[model samples]
Target: MRLVAAAVTFGAVLATLSGCGSDGPSGPVDAGGAQGRRAPGVTALPATDPTLIPDVGERLQRRIPADTGQVLVVYGEGENSPDSTAVFYMKEGPEWQRVARWAAHNGRKGWTVEHYSGDDRSPVGVFGLTDAGGVLDDPGSRLPYDQDYVAYAPTVNAVAYDHVFDYVIAIDYNRLPGTVPHNPTRPLGEDRGGGIWLHLDHGDGTSGCVSLPKGAMKFLLRTLDPAQHPVMVMGDERELRA
Candidate 1:
């Protein structure tokens, strides 16, 4: 089933790439998913410096879809269109392997830069890594949250989650209660994606979470590692996937 899915996704990416489409992420590109302003009494940035994202010589890198989540999604960096081209890669044993690479889109609101506009870009920071398998256990979805998983979708919508291949990573940029820590080993706030999280993509532009086709998301969730202290790199097209 996995192999077949991979083949289908590859073909789709190829097809879409061959014929670029401009009907993915809608609205204006706002460039800000994080609330930005620190919450009262919240003195320090959540261990995640939005200004400085270091590739710990780790595994995966994403390009194509652009949005910050408690997860990181980049789009429009290459031949991939803002909504139709994207590739999610992870660093494995020795090299950064392409777990899943396919078409994607970004926000239609084009980065609303607000708490409600739904155009806010994904946030950049260190959030708590959580095991939402049970917490997020849903008969509506089949994501292996029971395993090692950390997501940051503050709210849930059926369009994005219902898709089989979609994986949504949220950013804690927006202030909220948030989920609990899955792996207690890492520094509490430093190990996870702030309010950010990697999640599935809805055909529509996202409020904050990085959205993608279903297949790309599944591969990401299943193959992600916490020890690497995974970092989601986001910014201008030139700075992010360099």
Candidate 2:
């Protein structure tokens, strides 16, 4: 069955950006300082320069390659907020440009490094965007698309699952790319976490996936070019700066 996009409006996201100034963060600072310690809040990075997208900190930023062309940054409002902002950026020449920003719903409990199945917490860190799929046909996404009933089905009622997978961009957290998104062969051994994706919002928190409005999901699918080496940087505001 062809999936139809849903009409859902999400709340707005407030960003505490530091505004235009300087280059990237100076030296390496621990994410939120020493281990286990949390930063006061989100570190406003200078997105004004365009040349410098706010640095998510040394530990996290180091994982991203300089040549990566596309990045989706998901910033949760707090350590346990169900809401967050997902911004899409494209590397143009020497700098990155903010294409679009949308509000999103993350795991109900927020984020965690030790992610496990049914954790209700999204994993924190950078991961690749390598696949796309849904109940609908291909939406011109660069990533391989997998269209199947069970592939996008929700065990719950249709109301909770409706349009949830009309569009989905697989976040390569523990699964492999170049294969179907529903492969379920998680390299992280399934227990460490898997099946994380950027999907259509259902007006509520997800089990462990990130949900954006249907329009934003469509925009992401059409814009996230696999050849550009897309990746997602995700974490809580403080954990991001930390």
Candidate 3:
């Protein structure tokens, strides 16, 4: 179904372009500084363990709900780099298995623990993947899919953002779960920011959303199962390792 016209507007699309609306980090990296090293006091799963997700540390690792059987990791190249890689894993029996991996992009400025409006940084945390939508028709997603071309259209840099919203999976960060990806409700209050999603890559960094290739987006839409309780773990590699 289409989103209410009043709820989805060109202004909202603009807000998203600036890292606000439905699709929503930090600073420069210090090669020899803390940003370059794994966070202290955070233990990671043993590599020998089949469930181990490389580089994910104890802090974020513990945040993955025990019941969650699916995880998508967005590994950023650096604290200030927009480049990233995405890996999808599915729990198989007692072990997690890699199902797919794709090159991806994050916020133009990178990642952050405290994301705010217009920060142009994706949040660093583990968030549930609960909703899907886009300008295109549903691609057999297991999550609730909202299709509304007008609501999902880009209002700024139309040429550059063309088809970016053809598919999207809502990353539950500061947004109400089980709602449309474009829902403007922010339970954390507007200042905390919201609207972050996993969408089709436009060949560059996003304002805040994580962008992936169209093929990958379609793969995820068709494979991510609600019964698996998917969650996305994202941040710069070092932060994720912490």
Candidate 2 residue-wise lDDT, 133-158, digit = tens: 99888867767888887778865686
Clashes of each: 64, 2, 5
Per-candidate TM-scores read: 0.42, 0.79, 0.80
What candidate 1 gets wrong by more than 4 Å, as runs, is: 1-73, 77-85, 92-95, 111-119, 123-167, 172-196, 239-242
- Higher-TM-score candidate among 2 and 3? 3
TM-score, ranked from best to worst = 3, 2, 1
TM-score of 2: 0.79
In order, the Cα lDDT scores of the candidates are 0.34, 0.69, 0.75
* lDDT at residue 188 of model 3 (Cα atoms): 90
Best by lDDT: 3
Best-to-worst order by lDDT is 3, 2, 1
> On a 0 to 100 scale, what is the lDDT of residue 242 in model 3?
80
Tell me how candidate 2 scores on lDDT. 0.69
Off by over 4 Å in 3: 1-46
lDDT per residue, candidate 3, 68-145, as tens digits?
Answer: 877888888888888887766766555665555666789999999999989999999999998999999997788999
